[model samples]
Target: MQITKPTFYNEFSCIAGSCPDTCCAGWQIMIDQNSLKKYRHCKGAFRNRLLNDIDWKEHSFRQYQKRCAFLNEDNLCDIYSEAGKDMLCDTCRKYPRHIEEFEGLRELSLSLSCPEAARIFLSHKEKIIFRTVEKETPEETYDDFDYFLFTALMDTRDYLFSVIQDRSVPCALRRRKLLACGHDFQLCLDQNELFQWETIRTRHQNSAFGDSFQKKIFKWKDAEKSSDNLRKSIWKTIIPQMEILRSGWHDYLRDTLTPLYTSCDTEQQYQNVCLEFETFYPDWKIQEEQLLLYWIYTYFCGAIYDEQIFAKVKMAVVCTFMIHELAVGTWLLQQKQFSFPDLVSICYRFSRELEHSDQNLNKLEELLDWEEIFSLGNLLEI
Candidate 1:
């Protein structure tokens, strides 16, 4: 078995009760079979409470207004403190950290859903290093797994990350390179010429990816104009969708976005938005880099097992970009004197809307098949 994780693995400990937002709330905690059986035959005074607390038919613990039933006013879990640490289900025991299994490999990443996890992920000072170690003994295996496809996927992911994390190229250029790489890799996979991956690797490293990208930008009949139009259209669609994620989201959207949302006719709106971001996040470039890094890191590694390469990449990019857009919306609201909770509320809500929805995921996957002229760098452009 091979285990892999980012270097920041040791830096996280659930803030638990003190968390500005509790993981115990706002999401379903699925109970595993073993835990369910134990809960069924429990012999303690808490057994009746357990039976009542769990939605046994649904195989999930009941939530109180989106929070777990066991959560106390102090945000602590009553079950664990009273029963023992091991008494909690798998979902309760391990959270914020998600494990994606691929054949003999386990890739670990912290979910951005947790505010504390988000802060830690976005605050990293160095390029994320993925460290892999083989267990002293081989671990369990799936009934049928494709090791060859997994290796090929791993290679392609490494190539994608190299393009994304390359600092010399402008962010837009890096994104374009990645998109191109994904396209070419898909082609190679279709032809079953995995051995020629070396050629793609070479082309990625010593190519004029940025120069060609800039040409593509200028060669378009009306590039900037089209971009402005796209930006307006995208935000118009996204803002409304974000409203469905949680309560008060519409208020946050209206308070933050409505005023500045139309303040500048397309021409100056971009500049105003840039200035707003600079005013709020200070060194926003570093954070943008972190976002790109995280998206590529999490999804790229997972592609090793699931050959749904394009879906994973598209999901990564869309999720990060949506979060960025939402943050901008929050910033726009804050400039109008909204509170931090307003922004945090918007973030959490937007996450739930996009992250939790099967329909939204399918929509994004479909959109990925469409022609794309804008890249992450273009989004970053002031």
Candidate 2:
């Protein structure tokens, strides 16, 4: 079997008690079967605590006021402190390090929902690189696996990453190019013309496609006017439909974004805020590129499982765009000044709310198809 991970995969270390937000809280932690058996057999001073803390009926750790029962006042795991790391469950052991499995492949990525992972990703100025390693494991097979489609998706994703990382191209142009590539690839997939994907990829990588996409972007920019009401409507309509993981998140969005959107009297003022804020943070574009690449690299390949290629790309685009919008709202809250830390906070929080919930992810994907919410033209307008 082969494993693939980002270059920064090994660089993540949990902040533990020092974490601004603890993953142990505000989320359900499922106990794997192995861990459950081990806990049942555990015989020691900590055994009672383990048995008490877990809700075996649900196969999950019990939460005390939305915080993990094991999490103490210091925001550290009491179970870990008592029984050491060996006693931790699989979910606890492999947090932030997410594993997506294929027939014989394991793709590992650090979940942006973790604040430390978010900081590591946003702090890096260089282009991200992926690494692969082979391991001796028994081969597994799946009846539904599509090797050809998977290969094509990987090649297409690699090309998209290259375009995104190209420093000479503006970030907006790179995004347009990626959307164009996905649009074209989706058309072929819709027609069951998977064999033509290579040709489509090659065409997208060519200079002519980039030039044409740039022209389209220019025309869109000329025609598009930023609207605070449009932004408000988008968030208002979409945010409520998402599965609410933490009530605080819903309240946070309401408290922070609602006022910001309402205060902007004109589209020009909103655009000016975004423009001036970018000036304060000159590397905003690079940060955005990193975010886009991260989302694409982590989730895009999973399209092989469901053949939702375009939806995956749209998810990446919409996610990065929403994060940017949240950053803008945050800047307004901070008196027109934005910080890198604030950007990191927004990315991780957004990921925590959206990425952590499968239901929410599906809802967002559904919303993408709804023309009233996020049309392709609106997504491409950026």
Candidate 3:
């Protein structure tokens, strides 16, 4: 068996009580069977507290006013203090460290939903790198796994990462190229010409393709009115459909973003604010690129399971765009000032709302696919 993770994976440590936001709150903490049984047989003084805190029928910790029952006044876990780290359930033990299982491989990633993990990710100066290690274990197989498709997807993802990290290209152009790569790949897949991915990749690398892409981007910029309207319309329609994980998050979006969308009388004014926000934080582009790369690396390869290759990249693009929009709205709210810490807060908050919920993730993908808002041209326009 093999284990893979980002190079910065080991850098993450739970800040516990110091975390600006507690993971113990605003979400369900499911207790694994082994942990549940341990709780039932617990011989310690904390056993009664455990039995009272957990809802055995649901295999989850009961929340006290949207916080875990075990979460103490200091925002620390009482279970960890009383019973030790070994007592934590699978979810609690492995949080932020997400694992995706393949036939003989496990890919681990730190979920940005954790503020500390988000800090490690967004604050990194260098491009993200993935590392893999092999482990001795039992053999495993998936009856319906498509090894060939998976290989192609991995190769394409590597190519995309290289393109995205090629600092010479403007981040916007990198995004355009990434979307173009997805568009071409999807076309080939639809036509059952998956073998031509190499050709598509080769074409994208050519100087001519870059020139043409730049021209289209300029044209996209020229059609600001229509594009802005489309962008706003898409957000207005989709944001409402998302499964609201925390009512506060829904309110945050409504309170912060609603006015931004409505107040901008023209596309130019909106673009100006985005530009000004970027200028306010000189390294904003780098942060944005890092964010895009993180999402792509984390979720793109999962397309091998569902074969929704384009949708995966589309999700990354749309989510990154949304995060940027949130940042812009936040800047407006903070008297045209933005801080890295606040941006990190927004990123993790967005992740917590969307990434933590499988239902929301699936819904976003479904909405993107059904609406086709992330089509090649549309993505470029945005």
Candidate 4:
């Protein structure tokens, strides 16, 4: 078996009481069957509290006003204090430590929705790197899985990593290259020509291939470079339609977005502000790279399942784009100053609202599929 994770994966440690927000809150904390049995068989005063806390019908913890029943005033888990870590359910124990499983591979990543994890990733100055290791297990068994396509996607993902992490290229051009690659591979995927993925991946990874692909992308994108209707429409029309996990998400968007796109918000004006904002806070290049890497490394390979590879890239692009916009809004709102802490706040809150929810993730994926503005070409309009 093989396991892969980010280099900073070990740096994640839950802040508990000092945490700005509790992971225990805002969503249904589902209990696994094994832990359910543990809770069912426990004895003593804590047992009664467990019985009260556990909603047998839903197999989830009860919540009082959106906060978990076990959450105390100090924002710590009562379950941990009373019964210890062993007594906690799988969801509680493994939280912020998300795993994506395949035939013989386990991809481990710290959920960026957690404040600490977000802070750790963003604070790291160097580029993120994936470390893979082999562990003894059963043979590489994949029943009815397209092992070929999976391997192809691995190559494609490596190609994308090269594109995004090529710091010598301007950040904007690198992002545009991502869209072009997605569109080309998606066309091949549609025509059942994934056999050609090697040629496709190699050309993209080759240094000389960037200029032509970029020229073609420039032809597809609008001439108005400073326009940002894509971000505006997504923020104004799409986001509100998704599941609202936390109470203040809408409010943050309102504060972050409304000011950026007011009644008289012209596209050029909006674009100019964003350009200025990005230019002033040049670190946005790195921050946006980290954010995109977070989404891609986590979801790109999983595309081999349904083969909606474009959708996965689209989701990452849209999410990263909007997060940068949110940062722009945040910068404007904060008298034109944005800091690392502000970024950490935005990253985690956005993840808490979008990444943590199944409904939201599916909804965004579905939207990215059919929405014209989210098209591979249009997304590069930025």
Candidate 4: residue 21 Cα off by (Å): 1.1
Report the Cα lDDT for residue 333, model 1. Answer: 56
Which 10 residues in a row give candidate 4 its minimum summed lDDT?
A: 222-231
Error of 3 at 372 (Å): 3.7
**Residue 154 CA error for candidate 2 (Å)?**
0.3
To one decimal, what is the Cα RMSD in angstroms of model 2 from the true structure?
2.1
Over 1-382, each residue of candidate 3 has an lDDT whose tens digit, in order, gives 9898989899988888788988888778888999999999999779899888899999999997878999989989888998999999999999989988888889898998999999998998888888888999999989889888888888899898888788886787788777778877878888999889888777777743366768866665434337677777667767788777676777898777865777677778888878888888877788888888888988888887777777888887888888988888888888888898988999999999888778888888888777755556677777
Candidate 4, which segments miss by more than 4 Å at Cα? 138-142, 207-210, 222-226, 263-267
With a 3 Å backbone cut-off (N, CA, C), the pairs that clash in candidate 3 are none
Candidate 1 structure quality by residue, lDDT tens digits, 291-321: 6676676666555544556556655555556
Candidate 4 accuracy as lDDT = 0.83
TM-score for model 3? 0.94
Q: Rank the candidates by lDDT, best first.
A: 3, 4, 2, 1
Model 1 gets an lDDT of: 0.65
Tell me how many residue pairs clash in candidate 1.
1
Mind giving the per-residue lDDT tens digits that candidate 4 earns over 179-271? 778888888989989888778767766743356766777779765533555566777657777888778777878888766677226776776
How far residue 128's Cα lies from its native spot in candidate 2, in Å, is 0.6
What are the Cα lDDT values of the candidates? 0.65, 0.82, 0.83, 0.83
